[model samples]
Target chain A: EKWASTAPRIASTRLALHHFDTSYSLRLGALWPSVRAGLLCEQKYGALLNNFAAADHVPQELEPLNAADFVSEASQKAQQWQRGAAVGAVARGCQEGSGEGRTVMQAEMMAQAEMMAQAEMSPPLGASISSKIKCYTFPRGDITRFRPARPDSLGLLDYYLMDAASLLPVLALNVQPGDFVLDLCAAPGGKTLALLQTGFCGHLAANDISISRTKRLYQILHSYVPREVRDTVSVTSYDGRDWDQVKGGTFHKGAGAGSVLLQVLVDVPCTTDRHSATEEDNNIFHKRRTKERQMLPMLQLQLLMAGILAAKPGAEVVYSTCSLSPLQNECVVERALDIAEAQFNISIHVEDLSHFRTLFQETFSFFSDCRLGELVLPHLTANFGPMYFCKLRRM
Target chain B: RALLPARALPAGPGPCPRRGCGEAAALRAAGFSQEQARRLLALQPRLGPEQREAAAAQLLLLGLSAEAALALLERSPALLRLPTERLRERAEELRRLGLDGGRLERAVRRSPQLLHVPRKRLRAAVRLLRERCLFTAEQLREVLGTCPAVLQEEPRTLHHQFQYAYFRMGVQQKEMVKARLFQTPFAELRNRHIFLERRGLYETPHKGQTQISNPKLKDILQLPEEDFLASLAYSTPEEYEVFKKLLAREEEEKEEEDVDALYT
Candidate 1:
């Protein structure tokens, strides 16, 4: 019931902000036309709504449709393809049944269809991002819990288990094998689960301050992960800002005095927008959002600072929030970066997010002015996120 | 030739004795799909036609629509086999807990597990909240309406939750009730309060005097742990955990002293 991120609510909030006469508001206003244009364009691609099988794992039934069948299907699809590629050969084929160089025509039609699908799936992010890190653009399971039940167990287990947007923060942390990772606000811990799935960590400390929610985190990990792997994980009930005070001094045990946390995930709480909320939600979310608007940034700044304090020199810390509010998202990141650098010598790495920004731009609406982090708007980018994230390193 | 036909495959070993019969039809009539009816029967195959009929009748008797009853059964098939007398008693008990009529229906709709909790356990939880926690019957009703899971919690857990809020935090019954203190686990509340108190950020409310520095019980408990630590406590998660352990030890020592006094 606590669905925080929804595309419609985010769109409304962003659009509502455009009315203000400030420079930021004007810039947001200017961006609205382009965003709307992009959303309108992506909606025509149709594949945005279609649930696709992974590139590697096409269904057995779907496999029988040869290149030729797909080409013909592509032609049929191309006729419906709104703009750009609706020219010459494709148009001719639509108007007239058979034409010269039919085989070549099929190939061209197939290529055009593929491009259109790619356009719908992955919008071009600008030149700021690099291509090194793997980025998945598909907004899998963002709206509903319905993941494709894959034939393979591993495929089924991992597929769409989390919002694709959430995976970026985990990646931003740059967790290495044997790295001591702490997910500070890890409740119903999708990111912790992803971290455990991705690397052979020495230990993962997953803590949620809420004992009830932590119990849920435990149940999620216990059900999905094997006991041996789950045993390697330490589930603790503690406030995330006290990142330095994990019990038994286990973080300091491995190396000399310099031993500290390698990567920390600081996904702070924020006011969320789920498009599918009811009238009751309006009252609850409005009151909650107002309180959060006042209270969250201070908490976020503190947690980010604590994250910096807990990390080793050159340790990576990823700051993230599932909110579109500039105050909670970009402003908090900016302030945290400033305070950490001033107090703890933690270097705010803009370059760290370039690759992420690139993937973000390619995948969603990428705003450049969110100085410290990448902003992912809901309808402007893909249908999944109003998520924001930034990465920093301890100097 | 490649894929096996439906009938070609051998029957699954865990076959139910009754299939496509009265219970399945009854469930189907009550708006379950064929597959769903099959799944329901398969989950609790021990449920006889009479038991299923009686359960449905009891659910109807309790004012749940056929659809609601079917949905509830499909979600929690274990409810089908619970003794009718016990089920009736529990339903009446919940009604008495101020979740009467539509509220009772909705609460069950929200969490069907509320139907399966043992009677003695439910009564004990109610008693703890009313007598020990000093919650008025109306406040107890509000707690039940808001969080029915309170009834499912162990009586000791409820007692601990109330004790921590009332004795340790000096939160009065009215404030605690309004805050829905029973919704959060006792350990979490203890950790947050202890962290704040240790930081000199929060004060324990005294009876006659105004609590100038004391944060409201609602504000204190409403925050997620990180927010409480960062905004209110101005403490770290590590320090909070360490403090929690220290506080636990302190409570143990106090309990030991009380035991010694009782013995003497």
Candidate 2:
């Protein structure tokens, strides 16, 4: 009876084991080697271990798929974000560049057109660029031209040295055809260039104390001014202050040459605070301070007195400085008034620049309500040095 | 026992840092103490009495601890001669007066009148009281208090004084009732002459033929209609209206002519 019971139990156990092995074999056939080994071990237990192992491998394979999906999603989101940012950046850049760029382009185009028109109107003097002087127009309707000189290299250097702000305002205010203009402290010839550009002057007398500076001025005038205007302009090397003693007779003789002595520009020596960026570190502040403290005010007053003597009665005298100091600005004006006394009454009126507030504020102290002249403070405006100007009409 | 003289002992031959030390030493040799020599140095530097006293105290402190104090004294010699507080106060006062103390001190050393009492007194007084005193309404009223007395005086004298004062103050009368009196031609004439001239306009001339200056047509036309034209010139209302419109057009054209001409 005991043997019979044991035999039945063993047969049942063997059948159950066979059933587990069949399930595992099917499961492991679809799996990789790693999964197959794990499933094979599970078959020995004669339980559902093979089924569990196959299920575990399913999750393992799905994990990498989930990771891949996550990576793809992240990359797509980043690309979309970058595209939006790029659009915003491009729109901002276009908005900023458009207005200023358009104005500059238009001005350049107008200048070129004016030059072409002048060339067509005038007779062809020669094939040389210098032979036919060209007119270049500004946005404000002011026209100028470059006159080329012999030994053109020197002329080019002088042209590069010219500062437009120092010359343009005086040109705009004073240039009249057949008018005699005296640029008292004319050196490097920037103002002379503008004066010649107007084609209005009967004579433009450019004077400087230094011979070398006068040579440079002459070279520049010859290079940029047309031959007709170049003949009219005379460059002289003489102390402007002592011009009364030196050139008094010559000036009187020139007066009869249809020269209506109407305008004089007194661009006196001043503290070079505007050119401080170009100066060496140790010398910059000290140099300006010395000029501001001692030398400039005296030189300015003397030059202004000389200008008054040289100026024809009822002539418009423009006093200018590339300095921000009050001593050089209104104080000098006040001193001139004092020196003039009631004998030669002169009135000062300021030009308006309300459209250029940033420019106005930078070149002048905001506290100054002196509309008597324009102060072009470079700090407030575009990149420029501080400049002060006053125009007076001698009574 | 022999008494040794301090001068007989050898002293350092290094040059004195104080300005005018040789002069001070010569004065001292004639009979002066170290304090007197120091005072002389202060005088050379043009230090004020207050500055000199403060400087003495600073010098005493430095000399008592010479080794540690020399470096700082060398950097700022002014520190050895003046107390920091007094110097700071002086500097502040100079700044308020729109002057730099260092520059002023240097100037004073060169020329002693820089600290003359009268100049300093006036400057200080102006700074303390009158510098920013913009006249109030009450003050202006005080200035104008004797207007009635002025008006009651001889009209000529009163007018002369008024003209003198006005010219002195650089005042120009934009509007005035008696404009002819202020006119340049009539300016030199007295009020009596002006009164006589006004009275003479009503009086008749005692001559066979009285000459009268003829007025321009434009001036005669500009006269008020009631004064010269209402009774004599116009018989009809239409004529008057037509004349008024013509006058307006003439005035407009005159203004336009004025506009086109350059100021120069």
Candidate 3:
């Protein structure tokens, strides 16, 4: 603290100088007294500290209880504080180890050595850093997939179906039981079915931008969900970018919608790069859609930002896309973060999906180096995706 | 064996004949020329009657030749004013981390500044290397012996380097130290790596896959550009040059990919 202004300059100089001393520049070019005098004297702090010119950080003071007794739970922390703060580390620890008495300077040297050996045992820096998602999954199912036994009164036309990879974003959304939910781009409604299948969704407002797409979504929801379960859903046709203008940032769950946070999902449109490469009919890579292809990431970013603004604090919004482009996936999520934090003053945290990754480990080829979310890469046998999903918690 | 040489001094140059002459005599007795003692004092003139021999003796005992020791002292005169006990204490701190006498000599010689490290920082650095970087004590000794200045870096930067090597490059600690990964700036390393990656010459290591064909970390970092291109990276300098420019532009146009995605 004393040399705070000149500390940087002194440190640089120290690097250039070997055996260079700092008694003068440090402002305390004085002799240190033996431990007995230094610790017992009124100026013990000065005597104790002056020996090391570079001792800028001192150990934090101990808690009263830790000082009195080190509980097993807090002992590790207490021990560290003791070694650094002991001022007389040599006085107590050294006395017990070696019977022969030594000079205070000897005591200090031994104490430093002992402290360092102990330091080697402390947790390493990145050791605590783990993968954002845990994984391994690929389930193969043919016509014989089992369904829950239905009650006699209600009958649905058919079961709605989709690829297992398409449902990852729904899993990433972490929709809890009885939570109000919104599926922003619910067209063709595959992910919405996955959301409903979990049996955790209470009331969901499944939406799509075009009336035509919403018509298809209604058909899918009707074919799969019985009337009793379908009553909880309200299918709407509104541009995903301006969803908050319609919902007014609050999802009214039947009657009790008071300030509860809503779980939101936006499977934004993206370049189906792999499919576009293989298919000739209505491919995004076709010359007619060049402008639309280029504009996809921007539209996705807008939809995601709206999702963030439409939710209350603690509400989670998942953004997924069928795209391999880093530009479309990671880049879009990053822009939403910047735009939300800048314009709306809303902040978002990208949650770790290690748990989801582990649950589906064998099925998806998880892409590494994705900062905001997880990407399911396409494997020939496990050809489920180019699906990218990122979960953001509004804060 | 100190890496930084003690600056050579003129044979005889003193403003005055004999004033506080004991320190000058002590250096002369320790094998420095009379002019060397004068210049060494010019660097740090604080060595006193009691401190002069002990300070000179400390360097000699660390296996430093009088010439190398004098060069270091000339480079950093502050060593003269440092208390004898502090030097012993700092040396012991490094020694405990596996920088035995020979390794310690090499590390100090390479980075004379290592001698000035605060005991707090040294402890933190060692702990971080072992715990965060996952370097075993033996690998740490090797790292210190080569790039002792790493101890002076912030923990975040050090951890980033380790992660890039471990997860991104799929390199083990032994290879990382042997490649002297810490010696190169991360930007330069990233440029080279991305160039190779984009050219389809390198694959990022991921779990549950065999990536045994990628070039060794040592060959990637230690080889000359021509050799690196000719053998491991398998690309022309022109292509590598173009890629580096594109990489820089790509990096600038977006958020930094290096920033930790993991929320704290």
Candidate 4:
């Protein structure tokens, strides 16, 4: 008596299994040559069994197959059957029955029974089974797996998922432990994460105006940070311009004194045309251009002023953005520097991002003074999204 | 230590005949030769007036090296002689200590035993040795002789070393904190919760509003409020159908409520 079941209709599962087989052979080839050497391995044997079963009748000559072939074929088929059966069992195993099968017509009673049986065996869990399978089945990727022990874990994840553009320059600036760091316009927290990663803070404070966005930022930090490091950071929801106003004095004079040396990262919002690939259902240029035009210059200027106001004497401020617009990049920086010249002695030292010089020249021709800061065009370094940055030191 | 040429010596008590002879000229004018004037300018004013005169007399008498005379002058506090060689030797000693000895000596004398230990090491040692019984060098040596290396390697010491290195490297506590926070099986579930919570939509019952009782409805619309609003703003016509249905249902309910109120 032969019993059999059809394969489940899960594209991800099929793909994962295929990937697993290929990777296993490639990896295990050196360790066990015999396993990789033979073409008719256990997997192939299972395929052979399925093919034989599909035939109407087995010929007399082929009916009694060799013992080795029969054993290999039987064992392989059983293994595949067991794994698929396990997943299906779990999906149907839920107390509430699985949803209707993908292809079952209203009149097809037989298909319904089959789907009912499968659902009964395998119950759907809210969490993706693929994630669990990835964690346990593959030992290689499991090395970095860790469980959150405290509330601050989410905070740490916000820091880790930061883009390379914001992270690299912070590393370049080389913040020391117990140094003061100010992040202006640090809402949904990419630069905030970068700053926290430095661990070089007597005090680190992040500010953003949007309450909803700040809440999201808090969630990110809560998810990502361990309890130990989470204690170091403080998030405040406030307008960047009003930071000094709220303090009732300059940050340098009030909060920062003595051993507190300032390092400020001003990552302001710009028209994010660069996220065109990731954002579906929108004309990237047309949708963002108007807002980019109106706000980039204004926000950039305000953020730069905030950074300067917050910085200690002889402190360095790194101003950055994700837009390629010269109006936002050079014009705002130049204007701010000009305004700051008389009141406070300031010097501007631009990072020579010679690596992406050609891309900047090609994409943004208006800003001839690449001397202000580094510009990373997405087309040049495919690894990073498009970004613009400049560094200013207070004299 | 080469002998001075006789002709280079001043015929009478006067400054060196060199053109840049401001201080050298003043010393020579005070009854010293050109060589003696140059030597006098370099010496400290610590020596006794008589000792300075005697040293000057000794320079004329013995013809010894300036270093030897300065060393002899340094040993005699009563000798009102400038210890130029002693000051030079002290400066060299400070350079070896990677400090300015003159400045350090002043600072040390002000607050003696001021050990300029490395900040990272000091922190590590403080954390390690905190609340432990004070052990002198003799006690530590005795302990080391008795205890095994394995026994010496305490968990506290290991923790302190790890923390110190991390602190010194400026490793952000945020990363560790985040690792503790989010990298878990439940983290993704929590993320979804946070997303929904931010939008003012939650799983629990509310007083006035109709609860989202259907599981499918809950899953499909589990986004934060801002995201939900944003989606509504730019939703496709097909997505708007559901909202339209809800709106129509609400209108019908209102009409039914009015009818029921009239009947009552």
Put down candidate 2 lDDT per residue, A1-395, tens digits, no spaces: 76664333323322322332344235323221212111111110000101101223322433343211111222233343344344544554665557657767556545444333333332221121121111111111111222321223223222222333453245324555577888888887666665565556677788888898888887666555546667887788887878778876678567763437657888887755433323343322342344454766877887877777676666777888875566777788778877776555644333333212222222222223444566543211122334567777666
Considering just the first chain, candidate 1 attains a TM-score of 0.63
Model 2 over residues B6-63: C-alpha lDDT tens digits?
A: 4653343223554456655654553446545544343325554445445444333322
Kindly report which residue stretches of model 4 are placed more than 4 angstroms away from their true locations once superposed. A1-159, A248-250, A253-256, A276-292, A343-369, B1-264
Candidate 2 Cα errors over 4 Å, as ranges: A1-162, A257-259, A281-293, A342-368, B1-264
Better of 3 and 4 by lDDT: 3
- lDDT tens digits, residue span A79-148, model 3: 4434554444445565656644556656666756544443333322112111211111213210122232
Span of 10 residues, lowest total lDDT, candidate 2 chain A: A43-52
All candidates: TM-score? 0.41, 0.34, 0.39, 0.34
- Scoring each candidate complex against the real one, what DockQ results? 0.01, 0.00, 0.01, 0.00
Please write out the lDDT profile of model 3 over residues B91-206, one tens digit for every residue. 87888777887778778877888889898888787789999888887888888888888877777888888898888877788889999999888988887776665333566666
lDDT of each: 0.61, 0.44, 0.63, 0.44
Cα lDDT, model 1, residue A348:
61
**CAPRI class assigned to model 4:** incorrect
Highest TM-score: give the candidate number. Answer: 1
Q: Is the docking of candidate 1 incorrect, acceptable, medium or high quality?
A: incorrect
lDDT of 1 by residue, A208-254 (tens): 88898888898767555666787888888888777677642556564
Give per-residue CA lDDT, model 4, range B1-264, as digits (tens): 887776675454233444326655544554566655555544554433444555444432333344433444344423333343433343343333333423333332332222222334433433343324233444332322222121224436544433532342222233323222111223233333322321223333334232333122223234444454344222223223333333345456789999999999
Q: Which lDDT tens digits does candidate 4 get at residues A11-130?
A: 332232233234433533322111111111111101011110122222222334311222222223334434544555554466255356623432443433443443334333111011
Which of candidates 1 and 4 is the stronger one according to lDDT? 1
